[model samples]
Target: MKNSREIIVDILLKVEKEGTYLQLLLKKELDGFESLDKSFITEVATGAMKRQITIDYIINEVSTIKINKMKPFIRNLLRMSVYQLKYLDKIPAHAVIDEAVKLTKKKGYATLTKFVNAVLRNVDRQDIILPDDDLSVKYSIAPWIIDSWSVTYGPVIAEKIANELSANRAKVSARINTLKTTKTDLINFLVNESVIPLPGNIYPDEYLYLNGVNDIASMKSFAEGLFTIQDESAGIVSHVVNPLAGEYILDLCSAPGGKSTHLAQLSQNQANIISTDIFEHKIDLVKKNASRLGAGSICAELYDEKDIDKFVGRFDKVLIDVPCSGLGLLKRKPDINFNRNEYHIAQINATQKSIAKTAASFLKPGGSLVYSTCTLNKTENELMVDYISALGLVPDCTLIDYVPDMFKEFVSGGHVTIFPFVANTDGFFIAKFKK
Candidate 1:
């Protein structure tokens, strides 16, 4: 019964209130999206989410009513409308106002639609105000996150990271599925399809960068399993492990199975890869990916980190790609910035430490181990590596072995911290070790 924008408003409000991931919510709502307007739906939903805190600041600055006093629906409605007015230059203010007012009327808030219409009509597009004194508010990020980065890396570097995270065109990267196609052939295919394939700095032969193409999943090459949408940082993880053919490998937290399938592809389908996830139902994702990629070496399993004792000394190499506060993915997933907090960091890091320590038992003595996270915090990266090293594993391998030669400096003490700007990819922290 509702249009795309109205659905987005409902989804965004529910995401904020219920702490749901925007990507997952969007996928659930846009299951049969071609019949509807998927592009406009995604643009408004993600644009409003990415500028959420800033939109609220602008609303409170301009509106007579405080945001806290407004109903949740009104607050989200105002946010979506203000976002369109501020960022979407092509969309006229009157169109946004009309759509928002229509939604309000349908919600039986006819009296409030006048107030919404007035607020939208009065916003001066020429002049806007933001938190000038605070970098966090200026970038629409949490102050504590900014403070952490400032203390760890100087203010200038922290601001640069914030600027990139808040406003940057996140590049699309995909690794060629070696099982089905060669990198050269894939590049040729992409070029033939009019999709520019740029060389990736890291994992040179395995990854390619591109832009402007949407619905990668629906691409002919993608359906043919020619490539998988993976960042160079994530693709590098499987390379770091360097699984030899016929070796047994364990991938903890392997839902969606990017790294696991990469391991299978890299090993030429000779390695035995056990892709384990915490939830049984989610293991289906690993199965689906393995099937699409033709990675016959991968076998999906349900095994939570809490049950790590059952898997002790079971593999030649182990990948503890433990979960952490997904701060590294701000550019890729804007909802992460709004939902994550210091408490989440603490809880996730605790689990990370536990998982890495327990997964060590599954690696034979002298076997390789890689502890990785998609986060920028030292507590989750360097500290977790140090904690694992303290637990009887020794840092033995070179960290920069998997990245570009220029990134050798970031590799020190057997771990590499891939900052957003420094790596021009997801902010990931990786440590290589041996039991």
Candidate 2:
């Protein structure tokens, strides 16, 4: 039987080579292994990615060759070994080095096994001097990002945010479907399975840090549609939308239906929701979520921006959760930082503006329109709100000021910017407007 470290290194190599999501690939591979539990596997995968920069830096300092010049597999191997040494406590230090050396030997690099063992042992002896307080060097985030965030949020806040992004693992949160079960009832049910559901401070129905459960999909409550997995910030959108019963609502770019279905739930399934996405496959996904959650009033559709004239002024409320650079979700998807650049940011901003403009056209006079994205970029968030306001359709100032208490800290320039570090949720931006 292979140890978890060996298997994780193999999976990491495959992820780097194939350009797959490290988290997803790790989940699939670890789930297939009979001996390992979800918690242990999650720790290994996330630990490696979170400390990637520090691990690489240490490897470069110790290795005879430059770090980037090394093969992807060898680099990932070094990363996995260092993660075990520096982060994981249950795995003995000797076992960590032993497994890594074995892996190198098995790969026909028998000559390098001694070198691998020597490097790890040296690391254990504290030969590598890790920068203790340097923000960019310690947190493994790019220096430019640190500078940008510092300018926007100040030095202390920026450092905190960067540290949080590089922190261990994120908590899993789920909202109880009040349309189906009370929060009390849901908590009681989970408690029976050795899971303790804690109340989320921001939302009345959300639960955080529930123990003893790994995959929510396998839970009876999830299968019965009594709850849905959603970030605390994401769960805030439906409340902000504040859909009323018997109203005609449109959810543009509603795929996976997290917000759209929540809107129906808020309306007690009485509101008529026309959920549309550009992709046909995503329409089905929305429909599936609607059915499972018992939100029959939602009608999923495949739509194009050019066809908006047909449904002009038809909805009393319109929700446009437009796509953007996704800067807000760096903690959840660290690879985005490596892949995103100024050019991609500019392109995404243009698309977001276009989407907001088109969605605004469907709002009936005196109707509400909510523009949102899972990004913190000002160009996509505040600027889009400004563009819509310039169209002579300003947001309801009274309603905008009446943001929930949990998000009051983020209400700047009449828009909500939810930082994962500040809010203990995913990075999100939401603004409510009216015709």
Best-performing candidate as measured by lDDT = 1
- Writing each residue's lDDT as its tens digit, candidate 2 over 1-435 gives 666766777766766666577667766777666544556666776677667778878877777876698777677888888888988788899988988898898877888788788778877777677787767668877666677778777888787778777773566778778788888888888887668788775775555556667777778878888888887778777877888988999999899899998898888998999999999999999988888889889999999767778889899999888887776666777655555676787898888887877877888899888888887666777778889898767766544454667668777655787777765667788888879
Q: Pairs clashing in candidate 1?
A: 313-362
* lDDT, residue 402, model 2: 45
Q: For model 1, what is the alpha-carbon lDDT of residue 175?
A: 88
| Model 2 ranges with Cα > 4 A deviation | 1-3, 35-38, 127-129, 399-402
As a TM-score, model 2 comes out at 0.92
| Model 1: per-residue Cα lDDT over 1-435, one tens digit each | 567887888888989899899988888887666644777778778888888878777887778998889989998998888888988888878888899999999888999998898878766453666767788778987788889888877898789888888887568988889999998999888887779898886777888997657678778898889999898878768878888888999998898899999999999999999999888778998999899999999989998656767778888899988888888888878888778788888898888887887788898877888888888887888777779888999886565677566556778777877777865788787789987
Best by TM-score: 2
Per-model TM-score, in order, reads 0.92, 0.92
